[model samples]
Target: MTSRAIADIRGAENLDDLYRVFNENHLTAGWHKKRSSLWPEPRTSFQPLNWRYAEAAEAMDRAGAWMSTEDAERRNLLMFNPVDDNDYDTVRTLVCAYQMIKPGEYARTHRHTANAMRLILDAEDGVFTVVNGIKLPMRAGDVLLTPNWHWHSHYNEGAANAYWIDVLDVPLVHRLEPMFCENLPGGHQEVTSVPDPEACPFVFGLERMRAELEQAPARADGTRRHRLDIDAHIPTVAVTYIDMPAGGRMAEPRTTASRILAVLSGAGAAQVGERRFEWTRGDVFCVPSWHAFEVQSASPALLLEVSDEPTLSKLGFFIRDPAQPK
Candidate 1:
């Protein structure tokens, strides 16, 4: 530990001497000396995303008008958060995109390892997603889950284009190095008996869910909350519906889970740190991990919140510090 020893360690000329110095200094081989050169804290390059519904819908329409399902595959415009030009991620572990299917068009059958969900931005009859032979109608303000490795495809029988926000844990799955996807043999998956979209328990009906929660006991926190229990099907991601009454304010909450909130109805403002972001119906925004955030509703507001809570909880890293000071 003397200055002379430290100088000798730094001046080592041979591998054996270096190894001896490393051992004496309580260091191991490989990258230990390089660790200090990296960033001192975790840096998430992703930024908050807010794409207006009209803009998104128009872009999707243009794409749908020119591109066929066979040519464009999914007809999706992937959302890129502000970050390094080389990085294409909506968030650290998530990817969000706007997808559309035109009238009489279909998104071909395919499945992947990453868990996916869709929040209907504009709903219409005849626009349904077939997952593993089950047809679930996509309705406005409703959330549909296409769990990991499930064969799914979308079809638009309605006269208009179906628009939705598609979210997946792509970054997480890709980083884990087990990403796999396969396309079905035909343009779409085989359809079983046409089932009622309302009957599917996996679809979270926004108004219905809100009404049910209204009848239930209110939370001590003053927010009516209802979470879709799809852990048995989609284990990585979870979606919840939160309703805040007019003039209501939710105290800032901190959690380890990263959340994306879509305003289904009414208007509200979200405060993160010292910045406040106002949101109205059809707007989407993100809340990064461990950032204290509070929601204030100008009127009765409903939000569809998507997060990787189940994944973090399963990995033993999920923490909810509601008492944390902002």
Candidate 2:
């Protein structure tokens, strides 16, 4: 056996010596493929960031390996819900999206700040978002908010890999220089909400929302969400859209943060404070910080909204005196 092994080892420098052949004589003299280089070589080109889905999928494969790791097995913080902890200073405010994947199931822990929210570009029946004492069901076109400094998390209780776009104020706060963070020292924060869809004041089913749209004339006039202030809307806070009928006017809301209105499937006018906007489907408009505006749906129209909800509660910032028109 020894003689045979010696015969096989003839002219062989051990494994390391053989390995050095590939290491030292790599494709250095060959064509330099800048495209595959870890660091940019002589030739580099720029591509739109949105055009990286394939590369992202490959990265996700490696990340999945880490997620299925033993470390993840013991600790369940991997899937930090977007509303519960999506804020990380550099993201969110720039209006970016991210993912939180976990191997096991269920991420149930909550603290204030680093909150999470989701826009369901795609959703699964088993994927549900539990936020601030309420479990709001998920669906496409649903604009959800995981309020600031609030406890929240998500669960993919379905068979397939559920996913959604996480939305938060991380970018805004990161720019502001205050990146607050904390963990539930004992455990998750108290479950202020249950998984009841009705628990949430505003319910948006495309058909239902369509039916509920109040008709305002189509002359030079307009329409709005409601004449009522948020406080008056109460526990059943209805986040609504306003349409401009005949004239150019709006019934504004009681608000503190600049409203973000994304026009969905319509052509219209949106005026905040004093500025007016000509908008269309896929167009985005904003109300300046702490100002109220009226919207005139140029034609028939629709929109999406996010607001200072529970965040206003902790700070005691949102309210209106019913005695006065807010």
Best by lDDT: 1
Tell me the number of clashing residue pairs for each predicted model: 0, 32
For each candidate, what TM-score against the reference? 0.84, 0.43
RMSD of each: 5.3, 18.0
Cα lDDT tens digits for candidate 1, 154-229? 9999988888998899988888989999998866778785666567756877777877778767766678888888
> What are the runs in model 2 whose C-alpha is more than 4 Å off?
1-94, 98-104, 114-116, 185-195, 202-207, 213-326
Question: Largest TM-score belongs to which candidate?
Answer: 1
CA lDDT of each candidate? 0.80, 0.46
Q: Report the error of model 1 at residue 1, Å.
A: 28
Lowest lDDT sum, 10 consecutive residues, model 1, at: 40-49
Give lDDT tens digits, candidate 2, residues 35-138: 55453212112111121223333454456666642334212112121344443222123343434344335555454444444545445676666665566666
